[model samples]
Target: MKEKVLILNIGRCAWGRCIFCGYSRENYPEPNLLRMKVDLDRKLVGFEGDTLKIFGSGSFLDDKQFPREFRRYLVEKCKKKGIKHLTIESRPEFITEDTLLDFDGIDLTVAIGLEVADNDILKKLGKGMTVEDYTRAADIIHSKGFKVRTYLLVNPPFVDDIKESLDRSVSFALQHSDSIVLINLLPHANAPLFDLWVEGKWKPLTREKFFEITRPYANNPKIELDVETFRFVPRFPPEKRANLEGVSSEILNHPHFRVWQEYLCDWYEKPKDKTIALFLPCSAKKPYSKSKTHTLIYKTIKTLPIFKNIHRLVISTPGVVPFEFNDFYPFNAYEWDERLETPEIKKEYIKVTKKRIFDYLKHHKYDHYFCFFKYSAESYIALQEACNELGVSCTNCLSRETYEALKEEKGNPLFKEEALKELREVLSKVKQKGT
Candidate 1:
């Protein structure tokens, strides 16, 4: 990206868990901030950007997470680099005058998570701070000649409907902050929302519903809603996350897929040929084709040309997505936590998934239905059970016919071993670099 953005993840977020965020557990973990600084120093060898963003999980002002000496060094480093705008993610409580004073000359901006103005939602998300506290912090930052950016969630837990919450979140944010970032929920781990999902309390917001709710604020320039969050996944394993501040050309240049625009409604184009239906769960990476899970599945079924032109759909939080739409905005751009895979949660997902899958099946006529997905396909199991209840047949990898047909005529017998070899090689390279 010409913008020269430096997205850094220092360590775990200081305030512990935010019910909605998995940054602490998913990204950096309880990392040695000192070692993180050293690694960052190594990666910044050729950073020639004028704009700087210090976005590790913790509050930049938190002395414990980011030592005073290290913070001072970063400030001096940015100053020496001639940085124009400097921004960091922190809590409203940490927006002290003393901290703002550190960015006296640089264009400073403090981004905070004021998920919504509603007191109930704040309490539910475990945001110990309140909306009033955020406003005061924003005012303090503004007084210091700096900017304040606020983040709000789209579909939070306990909200029966997403439109009401989106409107409420946008209305309050537009009035109190310089910019607003609308974050869509990517529930996983023991995320409070995901907990609700397990009990059939909360449903993933459809793209149409999400856009319809946020349409009133669409024209507002200060409001920035990056649609990629719908399918955003945080894959930071060494080989996936490079030395480029965890940034890459594909990541930087990935298209911003919008689900809902007041002016455009034709986001999903249907497949005319209903040949054979094949469903799979989304992987932790974008472009599902590149994911190891998908690689294995494809290799297992490639010999059967008869399944070609099958209607391939990836069942995700956004609902059923055709393979043609896999690379689009919400297809693979989501970041869900890994801890949310309990047996209880799968039951809830299956119950809801069956409804969407049935709705999809009504329009498309397929000679046969098949599924081949990893454990990620919790909903697929539900789909099978749902079909059974309705006395409809859905073939899966475990099915006798499907298993018999799994061996591809030209497939490599040692594909799994080869894949593991590549994995070890990458791990060794990372280990050597750390030394």
Candidate 2:
């Protein structure tokens, strides 16, 4: 398999003042500041990948002054290399009928980061274009016979109703484009919005909260929803933190932590013989962008013969492939939260899962539905409820027994000694408090 090559440019953001935007700082280095075209060409020459993706900072269309020579160079070089797919990004305002014509015969995919479809939210985020602009841009791109992709940013700032905003965005994308990318916002120090956090004016969403918010988009079928995140907290050693800052300790201890713990626990759990139906709710977090969890799932699935009998059904936005599982059914949800932790986030998580289960049962009934992660608990509960409604049996692998079994399997003598030390410290604290 040829490795994928990505030519990224963080564009000089046109809407540099959106309240929730952390990548909109005025002094951030522009693509024009670097030897962009030369670097891209150099990278392309050595890359042996089947796909050459020209992407990164600022919109491809934002650099209106980029020499036509550079564009021509990219096309001719890609054609010569026999690159299978060429991709680029642009803002809605930068796309027009004439702009589409410029690419002519180059085999490529053009994507625009529209973020949201609501005009009010667009203005709130300082997105320069409206829904109509995006629609028109999609029409123009499609008319040129190029694949059109739209990027939707769920749970943007100033948007009180997260679900409504996501529904509207997904609806718009489904109606307009061939594919949609759903990205959850992460606050970074470089964005204009970071100061809001520094000034205690804003609070970033936890991973759990973000998953709950993006659940709806994850389920959509009409368009693909690709989950990308800026947050990178390592689940294990040898995984260094990405350029993003550390997440809160509270988020670290959140209930969903058990989900990952349970996943690690799966190694010890005796593989059940029942027909397992894997239900993945839409998540704002993309495994490709963040953790090894996706890879772990793929590996686990391969090792367990149970997966052969498993029916995987994912409900999410259209665009990115959800998983390597054989059976997938996608659906759209009302909202996506980009934050990771909170009670409200948990509530929404439960609600979306319930909706998915209801939809699944109504169409196709299953023997038993097993959720791999805690994020899918809502779906699990819904399945339980559906079972109750129809008197069927449903169970999860991440029960208390599974956790206990996992602890026994991870029998590192050092780990046991550390636990004993921690226990002594805790008892000492209790004795001191009583005294």
Candidate 3:
């Protein structure tokens, strides 16, 4: 049995001149590429257990010269080969009744890159369509009985109201589509917008800010949100690095630390109390075995006299001990075994982790549980469910996956320079505020 994957670079974009897009910038041999892809499809046709899938970079339906022929070829081949699924990407302007007709009787899903719902930001990004365009396109796709997926870009550069923009975007997608794929903007070397970013004219939201904007949509059942990391280069100056170096130390001396200390005086912090405890995960444990932030938090909590009178808890995987904090609840790492090498073991580990958290929360209650660790779909789902069961408020930090993606994309020499400068400015502010 053999499986075949075919990606067609069908030329032409519906919204060809989008400022932030560069999909159509690449050169392509349309007919030749289609022939090559078809030949590949034929090669896999003989295999009894084979599957075939077709997709393209630009708007698949907008390439009028070749897309129709390719679609026909693909549908016929798929029908003959009993293919599992066929997928494609397009813009709102390209999705219409005629476009949907092309996929008739084919097991296909169409995805549109609806970057955002804010018209002003869309214009800023040079997107060629409006929210109305996406809504209409969604209706057309749904009417034709095809599953529709939308691509959403969060915290785009130069967006002043990042939170409001994301909120509106999520609301629009939830109202119109079945599933949403959320991605952070990753500027590439050849991308048109790279120059703007490199010049410090554009910037992605900070990690903390990203989480604050997306927290509301984290647990929505109607929409399936998948986060894709941006790819960028890292470029930070020496001064910026120096400023960020001692942030944790300075935070330890802040008033927030004082408030945390007062709550720690009490064994249990209640939900009705003014102070709320945040549970964070610590994965790094070696030598003395302590989380840098956890240690800093403990020190800060100790300084806060009000912490003794409020509710507090540290939900963590067993690794490091919290310093003299009796309110800490240590949950053994469900997947601690380095020897568990199989997929089944990993699945069991996740199941065990979910069960442990659920079981523990069933008996205990908290006022607010803020997750200040790497954001993961599984962790977010589990924590949300736990919070729901306890009837308490729960929130998670920004998706680390998104941050990593942006870092990879922004790491280029051009964007990196600007990021370095911003980091330096932020650090300077932090130092000034600290003093």
User: Using Cα atoms with residue i matched to residue i, what is each candidate's TM-score against the true structure?
Assistant: 0.59, 0.50, 0.48
Ranking according to lDDT, highest score first:
1, 3, 2
Give per-residue CA lDDT, model 3, range 1-435, as digits (tens). 345656666555545666766556556655554575666576665655434545565777775635576667767767777775666777777788987786787756777878888788788778878888888888898898887778788767767776677778877887787778766665543455655654557644444445556677767765554433433332222221212111122322222222222222212223454334345453333211254545544444444444543233443322112324332222211223334335553444344334445554553454434444334433445556566766676654333444455455733221233333332232222221112
Candidate 1 per-residue C-alpha lDDT over 1-435 given as tens digits, one digit per residue, 9 for 90 to 100: 123455566665678667766566555544465776676677667877777776766588777677667767777777887777777888887889887777777888889888878888788788788989999998899998899888888777756556777787777877778899876666543355544443456645556666766777778889877543533332223332222112222222222211111011222335555466677776667777788766765665554444354666777554566776566544455554335455654565566567656666654556666665432356666677656766667755443332334334354222344433432232222221112
Tens-digit lDDT track for model 2 on 195-314?
Answer: 443344444554456668777666666456443454422122112112221233333233223222222222112123323455544444443213243344444454443455555544
Would you list the C-alpha lDDT of every candidate in the order shown? Answer: 0.61, 0.52, 0.53
Which candidate, 1 or 3, has the higher TM-score? 1
lDDT of 3 at 8: 64
RMSD of 3: 20.3
| Candidate 3: residue 425 Cα off by (Å) | 40
lDDT of 1 at 376: 32
Q: Once superposed on the true structure, which residue ranges of model 2 sit more than 4 Å away at CA?
A: 1-7, 24-34, 63-65, 196-202, 219-228, 232-435
Q: Which ten residues in a row have the lowest lDDT in candidate 3?
A: 240-249
Error of 2 at 377 (Å): 41
Q: Can you tell me which runs of candidate 1 are displaced by over 4 Å?
A: 26-34, 228-301, 304-357, 360-435
